[model samples]
Target chain A: MKLEDQRTTVYKVDPDHPETESLPTLRTEELLLNMGPQHPSTHGVLKVILELEGERLVKSTPVMGFLHRGVEKLAEGGTYHQFIPHTDRLDYVCAMYNNFAYCRAIEKLMDITVPDRAEYLRTIVAEVQRIIGHLFWLGTQALDIGAMTVFFYTFRDREILLDWFDELCGARLTTSWYRIGGVEKDFTPSLFEKLKKFLEYFPPKIDEYVIFLEKNRIWLARTRGVAVISAEDALSFGLSGPTLRGSGVDYDLRKYEPYSAYPRCEFSVPVGKNGDTYDRYWIRVEEIRESLKIVTQCLEQIEPGPILADVPSVTLPPKDRVFTNLESMIQQFKLFSQGFEAPAGEIYCGTEAHKGELGFYIVSTGGGNPYRLKIRAPSFIHMGAFDFMSRGYMIADAITLFGSYDIVMGECDR
Target chain B: MHAIAEKIQEKFPAGFLNAQEWRGDLAITVKREALHDVCTYLRRDPDMDCDYFVHVSSVDWPDDEERFEVVYEVYSIRKRHRIRIKTRVPEHDCIVDSMTDLWYGADFMEREVFDMMGIRFRNHPDLRRILMPDDYTEGYPLRKDFPVQGKGWRDSFDFLQDPN
Candidate 1:
């Protein structure tokens, strides 16, 4: 039996049941409760102002911006390269993907082309990050909704991915591994070996998760058709990533825009028939399987080449250049001091990460810094769809619906 | 080749649709003020169903007289082409027509523009603070004109002087 449908003695009231009288408007009973800004299952510091009708949420207005560090504004204060490190913190869970998105936008404005090898490397890291991100979502969502054991099993494998990330960059989560020109380095040999091993072993482990939840009758009854959002409604709300695909839109940035060498990589966008909590859950789980495919392809196809592009002014010269030649020393000084200059035009670049379409709209005035950079985070838009879906469902399903959306609050507030 | 820009070019012959480019899937552009008519045509015109409003975001351009440029990323899943419409509003008159009637998705996005940029949306329903606190009325945060680090942080626990 589902934990939600089972009567828990928290409030001694089942407000969702229509057979019970509509909640009374007694001044003593009605308490205006704050759900988050710190509470678990809110995903991040998402504060929801939920007015209670005696245990049932009558009106819920999501209050954001507690975590807003004026990122977009702070970006304007610094040079173009200075903003790259800031992007790492926007969506801390998927830092590489954020780095990729911000750099791609600047590249678009500057009219620079990334090397094929760098694109492939980005794809490998992006897909792996997607797997890691979705696993975090599935684990946390399940645990938040009462399936506690999923977290234990899910984090065990999550550590393996984080270990690979730590090896790639010094830090596990905030991997500032991308500059404007390309990635920090090519996929190292030791890292590649472990990833190849992971690609081989992770799929069956995903199936283990499926066997635990997908077939369980209680999990199905709890999720299936709980909060149904049609393709039309989802599109209207600007939903993307797994949330849009879960509703069977089949519009993924990887498939459509084909950025970061996604066209060369072989991975199908798994879509759903019905747009519900169950479909959203299944789509993410299936995406983990598909991301593994992309990762394997990227590993096999990676070429041994310089990770940074031929552009020395925009890209960092090797540390060897710092010690070796006079001209190389001058170039390194210019790059660090003046930073890279971009053309005077605006360009927007988006990619399919763990989230739907993460886009960066960058406007340049031919200077070393961006004139303006607007981040179109998918979670920020996806969070708007909450009221539409949560209207008829029980209050408990709010946690499930919010989790199924897979929002990272840092990005949303940023 | 998207029809809305083409139609826009034909309709306002002189200087309505300035420049249009198809970046992958979206028909992106730079337009000054005819946003109201362009969006109306996108929805009413049978050829373009851009009926589904995907997202709307604002970017601050501090140097230019036109300080804030709001970008509207729209989509028509029925026809399958996305269009990004843009407009630049001076800091004095940040007010713009709300597209909530055309697509309900614009509701929150408009509120966001109101919240962050302090750009007033004329006809939005619940246009109170969405991101910032209801008590906050000092200045717009997203605008490049806004200061990053103010002399507001307290060294000690100044209980009476919390700015946030």
Candidate 2:
């Protein structure tokens, strides 16, 4: 019999008296399916092994390390100043936050205080980077769930942010704009004007995306009540960022730790009632609105001042000073050749990256380079819950479950 | 932070090694054998309540008598304070009790430690090489003795030559 005929005949003769019929019983075995170390929906090179009985997943395991570059080992060999570029590649989508987190970790270890104006500049750029990171996630996630229009709309705004990044720094994507003391250079007057305009224009676009996705019949069936994780299980699994907040856990690192200019701002962290895919989606959208409010506040508060702190050995001197003064020239050469010495200690600094709590544990042995640097990447820990979350769900709905975590594999495998 | 450290010392006197504070974070080193009991007490005790498991990683200190120091970072969500629990494992006995029963999140973090730092975990349900490939027979990449550029794998790769 043909494959279609076999399936049809088994169902047709089995309703009233299955034992009385002369047909053999249909046997189904667990099927193993490999879903991409290279698929488009995975966001990066993440491979998942699925064992399914018919269409329902029996067991699932996420196999990572395809994009592993041994970032921790590289940190052991390089100077503290040289490691800033390495952080840019960890969470490449929100590159500015990676730079900020790593630099802040070093600053905390050495007890270096950032200047007042530099703190506000770091705050403004970091929030703008948060929107860019969430925008990329929203576009790709909506496309994965079969909504094509949001991808176009989100990317259209993301281009404007990227262009602004290029104008501020030299590059767009992997911008090493943040330095150890502060930002590389202050935002120009025109760049500040552009950021103010973007803050004004973005709130209505968020409403438009929400309007398009809120009542769509396909979006409702796909996301509502799908891949539900309770508040307690979400906490025990070590989930952070918006994924944990979606479960009604009010543990925003910004609100809890109050780093940088976050303590001065008067924005609210949105919490979800139901821990589902729709809640996570709603959390990111609401967060963008809150981030815009912070940017508007920063624009009014920012004042003109020196961008970099006046730390002698750590912060790089100005270009004019390096050209004219001999002492400044020697200081620049010594910093690059041998990084500044740090007191022997270990500290783990966790920042509210766009994805989650991006933690960096640096162990220095009073040397120029770190003795050991372990990155507590949020995506790596988030992937551990894949087997627990995806069990007993249809294999087709696995995409929705994976999409809800908002994981980027660069940080996962690093 | 000192109160919690004193509480653990009062409960298990022999298990506590010493407590050190750096940059306002408390780090308490404990005996390796008593780690499971200490962790369980920290999780269940109402005053301690270190419910959130931040991460579990190991640092290679080849010069020390106990060469590998396994570090566990935990935070109390309700109390809003953090602490570090450090336990040393000798080079020969690199196995530590797994916390998979306590927190579901430690599953892969322990496996990654086993894969990279060559540490093993007892009572772990699924212990295998996670980040490295299945057939990989090379030494642990994160160990102090392992060369950063790698040994023969890069130079022996045949496809690196020009095809034309």
DockQ in order:
0.42, 0.54
Which portions of model 2 miss their true places by more than 4 Å?
A1-25, B159-164
Q: Each model's TM-score, in the order given? A: 0.89, 0.95
Judged by DockQ cut-offs, is candidate 1 incorrect, acceptable, medium or high? acceptable
Clashing pairs in 1: A240-A356, A241-A356
For candidate 1, write residues B1-164 as lDDT tens digits. Answer: 55566777787565364555633435444454567667777877878877566667887777879887778877666676677788778888888778777777788888888887888777777686666766776677776666667325444554676678
Candidate 1 has a DockQ of 0.42
lDDT of 2 by residue, A295-364 (tens): 8898788788888888987888876899999999999888877999999999999999988999999888
User: Using DockQ as the measure, which candidate wins?
Assistant: 2
Interface RMSD of each: 5.5, 4.5
Give the TM-score, chain B only, in order for the candidates: 0.82, 0.94
Model 1 CA lDDT for position A341: 76
Model 2 local distance difference test score: 0.87
Give Cα distance to truth, residue B54, candidate 2, Å: 0.5
TM-score of chain A of 2: 0.93
